[model samples]
Target: MSVGDDIPDFPATGVETIAAAARWAGEHFATVPAVVDGDLRWTFREYIDRAESIAAGLVAIGVQNGDRVGIWAPNSADFAATVLGIQLAGAALVPLNTRFTVTETGDICARASVRAVFTVDGFLGRPYADEFAAHRQERPEILADGASIITFDGTGEDSIELLIARGTDEHRREVDARVASLRPEDTGIVLFTSGTTGRPKGIRLGHGQLLRAYWQWGGILGLEASDRVLLSNPFFHAFGLLVGLLAALVRGTTVYPLAVFNSADALRIIEAERITFYPAPPTVFQTMLQDPALESTDTSSLRIAVTGATSIPPSLIRAMHDVLGIERVFSPYGLTEATGVATLTRFGDSVETIAQTAGRPVPGVEVVILRPDESQADAGEIGEICVRGYNTLVSYLDDDTPLTDERGWMHTGDLGTFDEAGNLRVTGRLKDMFIVGGFNVYPAEVEAVLSSQPGVSAVAVVGIPDERLGEVGAAFIIPKTGASVDEAELVASAGERLANYKRPRRYFFVDAFPVNASGKVLKHELVASVTAAPAAG
Candidate 1:
């Protein structure tokens, strides 16, 4: 049977809105541990109650049903609660990346017209509230009038605790009424793109779309109430919010939120919390595998591992099973525009398949590769990957330009090819592809070949200006711990495996490549760095 054939239907019905889904989970998994953070633990019922109280507080603070509320905090139980509370109050959520500058944050807040922002005072020694205050002072006209900044932990009047304390019986009734009035088509989230190529744009997604997509995602991962999930990805990103937290709520799984990712801390949490489901980017797993203490660490509880967002080596997949003892590993392909997911690998896929290809499209979603002329590409032919399904974004926030064409296909700017078995192998971004002399060289293809080279832990390939060929490939590599890379050996290996045009003309050994929150390498930054110092390579 195909991957889709054995998948079960969505577990519940009539739960169109996120508010309703939270209520349903609370009733079904009332006594189950919903969140575990430091010394705090809350059951599903208690978690939902807290979310409802937050909703009441939002209502009491003059937030309207159709307004937008921003959450600028890290991944914590409080962030999770605030997300549901925004939904319960019938307001769309706008999650701000914790790494964003004040200018970037202010731009998004103004564009999304956020009514209130929930932040923290000190996270990683940075005061988010103070930074936002500075932003408001610098660009006062950009923000909506009376936009409030409420800290998650503080004693002042603007603290989230104070806001929650203001929840009265009347406000609770108002929250309930708003929740009941919510529609599946109502906007649920406005997530900004990572802005790797250019300025970030807000992608708006509805409640029903997120609910349906992640329900199947959870089912495919075999998520169950007995599972303990370690959410290491940032909550601002779709992988953490929709796939990690929201899916856990639907599946009744216990969640342990990690605000920051330190391999040692991650291993300790897995051993301490008995974390069964762990999902993160390939970098996280690679770092953990390279940690000297990995051999002695107790990670026996880790069962399912999900990773993607960059080229993955099959050897890494095998090491996850042989070394980490993980029973299953999956790699998925998605972007901010497609609700953070489009294709996923099945449970029984081979390590080679899981590492090389992003697997088949999810149930109810149609994926096809179209050439530049708008014709469908044959199997094994590279083209643009387009998606059409219930999970497509509702719209670009405040932008009238339509993302989908007349046929309802959302043309993703990603390049990929499908095998005979319908698995997609994402080659690279459309904008990232460069022409060498006359041949088109895809960075991902070269990066994949170089990743198999010895001593190479991670690699990112970008095209640089070449006076002779117009553009040539340049690779920035991060060597394995205590391992040194020989440039002559890499060149010889590349000549054997890749064509002359595809081989990187220059290589730069670096400590690390700059990555966004989703663990995607910022290629533009790599190119800019190379441009500034032409002699470095």
Candidate 2:
């Protein structure tokens, strides 16, 4: 039987806002560990108390309902608290990626009209607060009137602890009143997608959409109260904030957030916390599997493994089960616009199915393939992937591009097809696809073919400008430790397996890939590298 048919239906929760979800979980799972970051720990009850105080503190600082609040820090207890507190204070949250430069962060904040920003003095030796202060000096009017910065781990009178201490009984009452007054359609978060063409676009999502979507995610994963989640994804991304933090909170699972993804540190945390479920991009697994500590680390506590964002080799799934003792491995498909997940492979799916396709649509979502003329494409036909569901983004903050048509179908710029069993195989992004001399070339297809070869740890394929062929494929490969790959052998194999037009003309062996905090390879950077090379054909 096909994999998607066996998914068991689950009920969605009535929790509307992040605040409500935190409160409900606190009441039901008060004694359960909520946030475990380094030496700091908080149970669900204690976490909610701090969130309530933060909400009151935001109210005391003149952050009113519908105001935009920015959180610019790495994953920590304070990040989670500020996220929930902002929700409780009836303000939309804007999470800036820590990897972004100060100029980039300033651009986003200005577009969102952020009033008060919550940040840290520094992380990983980078002075983030200092950078923001410098930006403020350059553009004094960048922030709104009376806007301020509240440091997370900084000394001064305006720190987060001071904000909490400033919360009065009256402000606390106002926090509850504001939460009660919040409607389900109120803006929850304004996430900036790494737009391919120009500046990032703020994707506004509502409280009900994010709450129910991730509650459904907990059910999809069959998360239990006994589950301890190890989260490596950055909270600034949808995968981290929605699936990692909110899902775990709503399901009564203990969550451990890693500020920086170090393979050795990840191993230590898994052993110490007895982490059962780990949801990350495939690069995290690739790195950990290659770590020298893998053989010595006590990884038997790992039970469930979820990976995506890149093509998953069938061997990787098998290795996760056999070597890491992780029995269940799943690959979900989504983007920033779809609330981080639209389709997910279930636990019991065949290894081949999980490796080849991103399983059926989530319970409440409708996924369809549309041709260039906007007509529905038949099964097995590649076209633009479109989605219509509760999890879809509310709107783009910059331009009303009419992302959704009259019928509410949001045409994702990704190209893919579905099998008869309703499993989706994402072929490539529309922008990532380029034409050879006279044929269409999809980079994902070529990369999938190369990923299975021996000694190839990770690979990325990009189309480079070619005078003869119009555009040709160039592959950048990272070899596994103690293993070396011959460029001639790889090109020969591609010649035998892939179509002539799809074969990569050149191969570059690299030690590592330039990935973002969320483990996503920065393809544009790779393309720039190719363009700068004098010998690139």
Query: Each prediction's Cα lDDT score?
Result: 0.89, 0.85
TM-score of every prediction relative to native: 0.97, 0.95
Count clashes in each candidate, considering only residues at least 3 apart in sequence or on different chains: 0, 0
Pairs that clash in candidate 1: none
**For residues 150-169, could you state the per-residue lDDT of candidate 1 as single tens digits?**
88887898988889998999
- Model 2 steric clash pairs: none
The root-mean-square deviation over C-alpha atoms between each candidate and the true structure, in angstroms, is 1.5, 2.3
